[model samples]
Target: SDTLTDQQKKCVAPNVYSLAQAYLNSEQAWPRAIYLGETPIGFIMLDIDPEDIDKKENAYYLWRFMIARDYQGKGYGKKALDLIIDKCKEDQKSVLYTSCDMEEEMPYRFYMNYGFTDTGVFDDDEKVLKLQLI
Candidate 1:
């Protein structure tokens, strides 16, 4: 995955460094690199809510997703998300959750177009959205 510039970090929540730290520190969080053949283009972070682990309904979160600036608008993000959804389905998760800055138009629209609906929940200033898989 490409390193985010300071300006790009402002757009994507919890920048790459933070995501890496979270993956290292939390048992529930996992991070994966997005690649196109052999080239790395982006990164994704997944999180399973520890509180919901034993519950009948588990919430798998798309904690962070970001494409390299040069890689944006090339359909990589959509394809990467589709692959992530497939993985979630294979895991038998009922839904996938994510949050985005309300002010960031691109990401907000991207997630909505991919079937994530607003859940009327807010985590700090971010708007929460969920995609039902079952």
Candidate 2:
């Protein structure tokens, strides 16, 4: 349960911050543990009701996502994202939004490869990306 910059390893906030935010925003959060067999490899949290959060419109938001360094580049992230998308579709959501830093360690390209397009907006300094789920 590391904070935002645990050991200066990754750009994304660690599970501790994400999960804590999820707990505090329980009414709109949908946090899940990404597992490999029985072992937890990463964490993802979605703001299912984004309009209630920082979003200005009604949509789903990819609040936080990260896989441990040892588990990176092994298809775990893609699989976890697929599951997140499926969950949103299941709930009748049409759009999903997320933002990422321009830094090399960020998931910008990862999300782009998954069909997320830049919204030409910024959530703080993070560039916003969006995907259509419907």
Candidate 3:
């Protein structure tokens, strides 16, 4: 997350920023590395309520996710996201929310391609997307 391109930086915040935020909300923000064998390939952060059996709309969020510059386009992003989706299912979450800038370089299409739909919501200037999970 730290070594992303300038274009990518405009989309996702640095891992340090996400980690510090995670520190502030340790109960809800979950941060982890996307590792390939012994190497760290990416970073992911989730804002989730593991106890949300009722599956509220705000119960789960894909807070931050990024693949390193060199790691992008190598199938790591989708694979890492699958892991995140699995985690949400394990936590009994029925919906996953995420926000992205509306820029062309942003990850709106990627999330949409993965079944996330626009929710007509915005977190500041970022547009929110939702995925309904089975």
| Model 3 superposed RMSD (Cα) | 2.8
* Model 1 agreement with the true structure over 30-62: per-residue lDDT tens digits: 788889899988888888664533466576888
Measured by TM-score, the strongest candidate is 3
Query: Which residue pairs of candidate 1 clash?
Result: none
| Least accurate 10 contiguous residues by lDDT in model 1 | 48-57
lDDT of 1: 0.79
Q: Model 2 over residues 22-110: C-alpha lDDT tens digits? A: 88989988999888999988888888877634554547889888887778888989999998888888877778899888787458889
Q: Residue by residue across 1-134, what tens digits does model 3's lDDT show?
A: 35687778988888888999899989988999999999998999998763433444545878899988888888899999998888878877778888898888468888888899898978789998889986
| Number of backbone clashes in candidate 3 | 0
- Model 2 residue 22 CA deviation in Å: 1.6
The superposed Cα distance between candidate 3 and the true structure at residue 124, in angstroms, equals 1.0
Ranking by TM-score: 3, 2, 1
lDDT of 1 at 42: 88
User: Candidate 2 overall Cα lDDT vs. reference?
Assistant: 0.80
* TM-score between candidate 1 and the true structure: 0.83
